[model samples]
Target: MLRADVRAARKRLTGRIRTTPVFHTSVNGPNGQVPVTLKLEYLQHGGTFKVRGSLNAMLAADPAADRVIIASGGNAGIAAALAAAALGISCTVVVPESAPHTKVAAMWSHGAEVLWHGTTYAEAHRYATDLAAERNALPLHAFDLPAVVAGVGVVGLELEEQVRGRPPILVAVGGGGLMAGIAAALGRRRQVIGVEPEGMPILRAALSADRPVEVGASGLVADGLWASRIGDIALDVARRYGVRSVLVSDDAIAAARDYLWREFRIVVELAGAAALAAVQSGVYAPPAGERPVIVLCGANAELGG
Candidate 1:
């Protein structure tokens, strides 16, 4: 995926997706008060940026297909369901048994046939692929295809238009699709920092190995960042665009999520808070006079009344 591909995706998704807002504010980081820009993509349709990729993949592929199958920990399944519904297609989502109840319920509400299988997203992905092959249904991956990554690049395209000077961007990483798309969209102009949970450091491990490597997934934030390996496309883009990787502890992620709620009244899932955790915990501190942008990428949490 590249900037041109991303621009084409934006044109295709002109009215199908939303142009989420951006908020500029100051927050007390470990260093001191820091000015930051927040890309409020958590408020996106299906409660996450995955909707962009899901919708784009379906639209770019065979829109006349009647049935589609997808596997996700939560957010991607909700996105696939939403996209399938919009395209008037039947969708079956296979998710790990441990996926959050709220996300599963949202998928069901979107008219998807929800199936629970295995305990990890990798296992569920295998099952979903097999089922799709057997049923002759179109299969949608969470974050690996060209159309999907190109669609996700729209986020960075919007960020470039919304923020000035091409500041560094902090985004949470799962399979590395979001980070890759953003990096491809920016074309090595701006820095893109990928944040991941310490326990499930898929991108970090891949960077260390100079290839996409499988990692054990276990963390408080694993519900959203459970990909065992980074996608090949993400690794290629990261290598080409100098994408940086950082890790944050589960405790830091929890604290960051709570801080957003208390200070900004923002409700985000643990994964959504990972990038902020990198900033708040001083894991990826910016240089002096460098303003950074943090992306709140998902809001699939079960907010109690």
Candidate 2:
């Protein structure tokens, strides 16, 4: 059912979004001589990859689904709101206290009612779940559903089309949605790696503990990467597909972001910079005779840089 659903999502998502391009980046990392392919997904409209899954969820679920509700730290909410607006449906997003004012404003700008829940994502999710049930709204999961995962997989499928062969390494992670989609899309391929910030190693910690444990959010990348726990759906997909997880630090991510601005002349958010941090900081050193790919997932940033 999940596989079929994902396929349907891919079909539904076609022509609805831009398939961002991939280019071999020349940035030198601590890991010796390895060419890197950058999956420039930030070029996609809505300024991030969230639109893929948001649109997919909206299209796949009951179109008659009145009042869609979602829980998000930010990006997903904006995506949900945009999707709902396009579909002519209403949406409400519950966000954590830590969610930036900019994000809440963005959600509101897209026509989503923003409610501040507790201090963390889990608490917000619970509140959103209750509100969704109470309002008789259909829930659009932030991450962790076959439809959502498949929509994200479109990024991977497009990457595969661009690369056409094993790239030796590819990296991405979020609330585990992007990684789950990439992993399922790449199935059994050992090179696609999932990278997370040290403080929000929901997926990595899950791999170590063999279960998803609540890890309070911390780090610059905390905005998008830190979910108290990995999505149960994401964890299952990851574990079943043998995806590897690694952690990088806030400092490394900052440097990576600076590097992108300085060298590549690109703008990306903290969560979007993790894979670059992993390589440059030696958090994820590539093996000899292997290539690497970094998923530049988003660019939801404060303007006037």
Candidate 3:
């Protein structure tokens, strides 16, 4: 999508979505403390940035459509459910059996019909599509659609206003919807980096192969970042905007999560800490005097004692 499309999405999302706050902080670097900003998008409605795209897509669709169907491991399902609830539309979310119980419960709380279909997101997606066809319901992809991508691009616009210089923004990727929106919105104005799990390096593998490819998704954050293939629109936007990828191990991700809670009193899901893990683990080193922005993408974890 283009900047104009993102702008339109932003306008449509004005009051519907939360303008998630950005926390200005510094992270220890090779030299010293390097300035950084954390976009606390995990605090958004449904505990993820996915709601932005979900709301935008639903707003543009026919209002007469009674139901909307989508397949998600967690965050996207919650997003669609929340959006559907806001618009008074029925929502059906098909999630993998491995999805977190807290997320499924949240969808149920939103009055959605939830189904456990398979072990992987791809399988759940197939079932969701078939069910939508059978019911003649509107179907929504977690990522890949123009409206969804454009809707997510609003985060970049908000960041531009929240920070001083155009710093590189580190985003955790699942299906690459959020990354594509931010990259297309910012264009060449700022650098965009995609952080993925080492096992599920969807964007990295796709970039290397010069096309979208399926990769195995198995890790601590698999439920949240478990898209086997990056979306086609995301890949195209990444190429056009020079989006780079960084891989982080599950151990590093866990460490990052602990560090956030210990230092900043921030508790987030494993996928939420992936971008910070890249910096803390030294996988994606930032140059001296360079300030980067990291996006904490989701907060759908069960906080148990």
How well is each residue in 159-260 modelled by candidate 3, as lDDT tens digits? 989988878999999899999999999999999999998989999999999999988667664553388999999999999999999999998888888888
- State the RMSD for candidate 2: 2.1
Per-residue lDDT of model 2, residues 25-90, tens digit only:
667688454567888988877777888998888788865676889998878888888888888889
lDDT to native, each model: 0.89, 0.79, 0.90
Candidate 1: tens digits of C-alpha lDDT, residues 75-113: 999999999999899999998888888889999999999
Instruction: Tell me the spans in candidate 2 whose CA falls farther than 4 Å from its real position.
Output: 1-4, 31-33, 221-225
List of clashing residue pairs for candidate 3? none
- Model 1, stretches more than 4 Å misplaced? 222-225
TM-score-best of 2 and 3: 3
RMSD of each: 1.6, 2.1, 1.6
Candidate 3 residue spans exceeding 4 A from truth: 29-32, 221-225
lDDT of 1: 0.89
Highest lDDT against the true fold, candidate: 3
lDDT of 2: 0.79
